[model samples]
Target: MYSWSCRFGLMMAAIFAVSSGQALAQTSAPPVKASLRLDWKGGGQHAPFYLARDRGYYKDEGIDLDIISGSGSSDVVKQVGSKAVEFGIADALVLVQAAEQRVPLTAIAAYYQRTPIVVLSPQSKPVTDPAQLTQGVKLGSKKGSATFQGLTALLAANDIPMQKVTLVDIGFGVQPLLVKQVDAMMGFSMNEPIEAESAGLPVTVMAIADHGVDAYGLMIVSNPDLIAKNPALVKGFLKATAHGLSDAAKDPAAAVAAVNNAVSESDPARETKVLDRTLPYFQSDDKEAHGAGWQSESRWEHTIAIAKKLGLVERDLSAHQVFSNDMLPH
Candidate 1:
């Protein structure tokens, strides 16, 4: 037999060769194809997905991700529930409503920790409180919207009768509010508020969450079929997505840059403002203590209760039935 040192050297070489081969195989394997549908057209709110795509986070998890712009959150929920796509980002309350209708959607991660709905009024003549919205106030309302649903919930919780204020129907523009056609309007804090401010119309924003109507906002959703059939893929996608969100939060400029690079029609300056306003809503007491995308059951239960009051859901739903924290990266 050969000396001990010679045998040990040969064994070491064999182990190195095996490990190298494994590493090469992993690097060379074709990435699995995946797609993500957004709640709306690409904007600053969606920068993390683009950032993830640009930084190869999905690729690192063997996922070839294609991000698709969508018409709306409800439409996205329908598409994902129908199994037309593997994943989607949508409003969490919308997901609960869909689930009540026997949709197969399950929220895998909480993207926004708080609702962004706000009552917008000109700062000169502000509607400071919900109680102030009584006296024949012409409240601009976009009916059949997620924010409208939130408005209804706020009214119910605060014991404000629907008849207390006159609902002025408006389209998806701030012109109605700017021209004093309506005293106040319901819109997202990030969208209409930013638009109004940019147009030199500073607004008095009353957040719904601050007025006893708290709820989880947008979330990452997937179907049970995908979650059951390919659990690893689900976990991998969440891991990559979480990393992308973390990176986006840390370097918003880079995130905006990545989004602009991907979408030719995107406006950088406007998107920058939107992203700046959006980043704060991503944090919560539970998120700070646990980690990103951590859902608190009590908070979710409260949201479901609000959905029930708004008649968005036909029946009661438990918080656990609509979401799962299994996929989030620890």
Candidate 2:
């Protein structure tokens, strides 16, 4: 029989061997290949994902992510819903609309807690209040767009009649406003206003959220099938994305630089300004407490209400049906 000391040493040796083996296995495992389709082409708001990609956050979480620029939020939702891509960044309204159509997708995280829709007018003739929109003001609107829908909802909530304001047909870009084609335009707070400023036209911005048109903005989405089958992977993706968002929040310039590095045509100066405007939408009381990527049930409900008001979704939808905070990092 062996001495007590000898048995103890053998037991320690076995434990060490098992621990080392586990570590080796973890380090040796291959990363899961994942693809993320963005709502639109690369822009300042998309910097965090590029930052995370370049900083190795996703790699640290065993995800080899490929970021793909998309045509629009609706396209991104369809791509994720069809399993054409592993994940996507899209507008919350589009996700709800897609869900109503029997799409197999759900919002995993909210990128912007508040809507980015705003009324933009040149400083020469600024629209200071949404109430002024009813006083024979010409408003630029893109028909069949979420912005137009939001504008109508904003007007109705403020007790302004749609017939009172003259809405002019306009395409994307700030030219319609800059050229005085319309008195003011309904556009994204982070996008057109910045573009107008860059072109030497200072403008007044009336945020729709401030006028009781609150709705969730862009969100990260994934199909329910993948989420059900590989919850761990979903959790890891969110954790790594949260890491990117935290880093971006701490050093926004660095995040913009990452975007510049990834997209060949990016303008750093303009993107820096875009990131500045976009950052404020990222925070809320819930995110401050629950951590990044947290989704509020009430906020989702409010979004559904807006979607219903706009006739974007016909079916009844509970807040929980479209989003979950389960995958967010604690």
Model 2 TM-score (2 dp): 0.92
Q: Which pairs in model 2 have colliding backbones?
A: none
- The alpha-carbon deviation from the true structure for residue 299 of candidate 1, after best TM-score superposition, in angstroms, is 1.5
Q: Estimate each model's TM-score.
A: 0.92, 0.92
Query: What 10-residue stretch in candidate 1 is worst by lDDT?
Result: 309-318
Q: lDDT of all predictions, in order shown?
A: 0.89, 0.89
Can you write out model 2's per-residue Cα lDDT over 124-210, one digit (the tens) per residue? Answer: 988988878877788998998878988987986788878888889889898988888899999998899998998899999999999
Clashing pairs in 1: none
Cα-based lDDT at residue 4, candidate 1:
98
> Model 1, range 197-273, lDDT digits (tens) per residue?
98889999999899998898999899989999999889889888888888989999999999999988999999999
